[model samples]
Target: MNVNEITPFIGLELSDASYEDLVRPEVWEQLVQGVQERELVVVRGIELTPQQQIDLAARLGEPVPFLISKYRHPEFEQIMISSNEMKDEKPIGVARVGNFWHQDSSFVADPAPYTMLHGVNVPGTSGHTKFANAADVYDRMPEEWKAKLSDRIGLHTVGKRLRIRQEHVGLSVAEFKALIDIEHPKVEHPVVCKDEYTGREYVYGSREYMDSVLGFDPNENEAFFTMLDGLIHDETHVYTHKWTPNDLVIWKTRTTYHIATEVEPGASRTVHRVSIETRRP
Candidate 1:
C-alpha cells in the first residue's frame, strides 16, 4: 500500500491496495493507525457491497445502524447513502446530509468514535468533505482560553441541526424527530475531552450540534462559541477531500469535526455511511 499525506494534521490518502487486502491483519493495522494518527484516512479503489461494508466496519468496532429511515438502504438497513438522483421524480436518498461541521453522534451520551463512508457515485465538479483537526486547534489555543474551557461544558442536541434541515426539507421538528428511533435530548459534554485511545485532548462539539455553553451569560456564551468556531475551522487547521469512486473514508470523531462541502442541486453524490462505537476505545 502507498500512503500520501493530504495535510499535516487532517487527512491521509492510501492507494495501491484492494478491498481484499483490507482484511489482512497488517493492512487492518495500517488502517487503524492511519485513523488514529491522521484523524481522517481515505483509501482509493476499494468498492464494497453493503455486506462487505458492514463486515469492514465490524472489524474496526461495533457498527452503529442508521437511525433515520429515509436514509437507510432498503436492502441493507446498516447502510445509509442518500443522493439527489431522482427515481420517478422523487429523491432516492437524503442530500446534503452532514453539511454542517460536527462530530457524528456527539449530541448523544456515548458518541461514536469513528465514521466511515464508502464512495459510490461522486459528483465530478463538486461535493468535497472538509475536516478540521480539533486536537490541533485545541493544542494551539492560548493558556487563558484553555483555562476558561477547562471545566466548561456545552449543550448539544439534534434539535440544533434538525431546525436547519427542516427548513430545507419542510418537516416540522416533531415530525422529523418522530421519523427516527434515536433519542436526542439535549446533552452536555466537556468543552475539551480526552481521546481514550491516544490520551490527547480535543475540542468536542460544534456550532451545528451545540446549543450553548453552560454557566455563562448569554453574550459571553455566544462570544466563546463564536471564537471556538472561528479557531477550529480556520483554513490552516482544515483539509478538504475530493472524492473518487470506491474511495472509502474513515474519520475519528474524537479528534476531528467534518462538513460536507456543496454539490449542485440534484447532482448525484452517494456514499454509504456507518459509525463505530467509541466503547472499545
Candidate 2:
C-alpha cells in the first residue's frame, strides 16, 4: 500500500491497497493510528458493501446505529445512508446532511470518537467534504484565547437544528420542546478537550451544536464564539476532499470538524456512514 499526505498536517490518503489488505491486523493498527494523528484518512480504490463497511467499523470500534431510523440501511441498522435519491416520492436517505461544521454526536453524553463514510455513488463534480483540524487550530491559537477557553465548558444541544426542522414540518413549539427533552436534552463538554490516546488538546465545540460557553456573559457569547470560529475554520487549516465512488473516508471526531458542500442540481450522490463508539487507547 502507498500512503500519501493529503496535506502536511490534516489528512492522509492510503492508496494501492484493497479492502482485504487493509483488514490485516498490522495494517489496520497503522491505519487507526494514522487517523488519530492526522485527523482524517482516506482509503482510495476500494468498494465496500454495506456489510463490509459495518465489519470494518467493528474492527475499529463498536459500530453504533444512528438516532434517525429512516436513514438506517434497510438490511443493516448500523449503516446510515446519506443520499439525495428518492423512492416513491420520499427521500431514500437523509439528504443534505452535515452542511455545517460540527462533530458527530457532540450533543450526547458519550460522543463517538470515530466516523467513517464510504462513498457508494458520487457526482462527477461539485460534491465535496471539507475538514478542519481542530487540534492544529488549537495549537496555533493566541495564548490568551487558549487561557480563556481552557477551563470553560460549552452547552450543546440539538434544539436549534431541530427547531428549524420542526418549523418546516409545522410542529408546535411545545411539541418540539417535548420531543427534544425526551430524545436530546442539552449536554455540556469542555471547550478544550484532550485526546485520551495521544494527549493532544483540541477545540471541541462547533456552532451547529454548541449554543454557548458556560459562565460567559450571554451578550458577549456570540462575539466570543465568532472569534473562535474564525480561527477554527481558517482555510489554511482545512482540507477539502472531492468525493469519488469507493473512497472510504474516516476521521477522528474529537480532533476535527467537517462540512459537506452543495451538490450540483440534478446530480445524484449516496454515501453510507457509521459512527464508532470511543475505542480504547
Candidate 3:
C-alpha cells in the first residue's frame, strides 16, 4: 500500500490496496493508526458492496445506526443514506445534512469515535467535505483560553438544528415536534477532551449542537464559540476532500470537525455513512 498526506496535519490518502489486502488484519491496523494520528484517511479506488462496507466498519469497532430512523438503509440499519434523490416524490435519504460544522452524535452519551463515508454517487461539478483538526486547534489556542476552558463542560442538544433540517425537507411542524418529543437525553462533555487512544487533547464542541459552556454566561459562551470558529477555520488546520465515486473516507471523530459543501442545484450526490460507537474518555 502507498500512503500520501493530503495536508500537513489533517488528512492521509491510502492507495494501491485491493479489497483483499484491505480486509487483512495487519492492513486494517495500519489504517486505524493512520486515522488516529492524521485525523482523516481517504482510501481511494476500492470497490465494496454495502455489506462489505459494514463488515469493514465492524472490523474497526461496533457499527452503530444513526439516530435518524428515516434515513437508515432499509435492509441494513448500520448504514445511513445521504442523498438528493427521491423515489415516488419522497426523499430516499436525508438531503443536505452536515452542511454545518459539527461532530456526529455529539449530543449522545456515547458518541461515535469513528465515522466512515462511501461516495456511491458524486457530482462532477461540486460536492466536497471539509474537515478541521480540532486537536490542532486546541494546540494553537491562546494559553489563557486553554486554561479557562480546560475543565469546562459543554451542553449539547439537537434542539433548533432539528427544526432547521425539518424545514429543509418540508416536514410539517407537528411532525417535527413529534420527532423531538422522543426524549433525547441531556448530554454534556468537556470543552477540551483528551483522546483515549492517542492522549491528544482537542476542542469537543461545535456551534450547531453546543448550547453553552457550563458556568459561562451567554456572552462569554458566544465569545468562546466565535474564537473557536476562527481558529478551526484557519487555513493551516483545515483540509478539503473532493469527493469521487467509490472513495471511502474515514476520520477520527474526537479529533476533527467536518461539514459538507453545497452541491450544484439539481446535481446528484449519494453517500452511505457508517459510524462506530465508542465510550467517552
Candidate 4:
C-alpha cells in the first residue's frame, strides 16, 4: 500500500489497497500503527456494504453501540447512520450529528480512543472533516500558558452537548436537559493529558463539552479555554479532509479533535461510524 501525507502533523491517506487487504491481520496492524503515528488515517478506493462495514470494524476494534436511538441502523445497533436523505416523508438517517469540535465520547469518564468513519456517500464540494492535533498544539504553546494549564482540570458534561444539539435543531435546551439527565453534573479531566500509546502530552479541551476549568474563576476559565480552542484550531495544526465515496478514515481520539462541516442543502452525505471500546489514557 502507498501512503500520502495530507499535512505535516495530522493526516496520512493510504492508497493502492483493497478492502480485502484491510481486513487482513497484517494490514490491520499496519493501519493501526499508521493512525497512531499520524493521528489520522484515510484509506481510499474501498467499498463495503453496511454489513461488511460492521464486520470489518469489529475486526479493527469493538464497535461501540449507538447511544442515539433514532440513529441506530435497523439491523445493527452498533452502527449509527448519518444521512440527510428521506423516504416516504420520514428522515432516512441522522444529519448534522456533530457540528462542533469534539473528540467522540469525551464527555464520558472513559472516552473511546479510536473513531472510524466509512463513507458511503459524500459530497465533493463541502462536508469536510476537519482535524486538529492537540499534541502539536500543546507543544507550541507559550511557557506561561503551559504552566497555567499544568494543574488545571476541565469540567466536561454530556448534558450540555445534548442541550446544544437540541437547541441547534430548534428545540428548547431547558426542556431537553430536564427530560433526560443522561449526562449529570459534570466530569473532571486534566487539561493536559498524556497519550498512553505515544507517550506524548496534549492539551485536551473541547469547546462543546468543557463546561469550565477548575481552580480558575468564571472569567479566567472562559478566556483561557477560548484561547486554548484557538490554539487547537490554528491552521498550522489543522487538516481538513474532503471525503469521497467508499473512503474510510480513522483518528485517535486522545491526541486529536475533529469537527464536521455543513453540507449543501438537499445534498446527502452518509457514513457508518464506529468507535473503539478501549478507554483513552
Best by TM-score: 2
Q: Where in model 4 is the C-alpha error above 4 Å?
A: 163-183, 279-281
Candidate 4 has a TM-score of 0.90
User: Deviation in angstroms for 215 in model 1?
Assistant: 0.9
lDDT score for residue 179 of model 3: 59
Question: Candidate 3 lDDT (Cα, whole model)?
Answer: 0.85
Cand. 4 Cα-lDDT: 0.80
For each candidate, what is the lDDT? 0.81, 0.86, 0.85, 0.80
What value of lDDT does candidate 2 attain over all alpha carbons? 0.86
Q: Please write out the lDDT profile of model 1 over residues 1-281, one tens digit for every residue.
A: 89888887778888978878888899899888988877888998787888898888888788866887877888877787667677788777887688888888788887778888998999767898888888887988788889888889888887766644444387665777665325457888898888776778888878778778798789887877788888877887788788888889998876788888889776778888887874455
TM-score of each: 0.89, 0.93, 0.90, 0.90
Candidate 4 residues 13-123, lDDT tens each?
888788788888988888888888888899985887777777766765678788877788888888788888777887767886788888776777877777888888899
Please tell me which model should have the higher lDDT, number 2 or number 4. Answer: 2
Candidate 1 regions off by >4 Å? 163-183, 278-281
Task: Residues 132-225, candidate 3: write the lDDT tens digits.
Answer: 9888889899999999997899998877576454343775778665656465545899899888767888999888878889999989998998
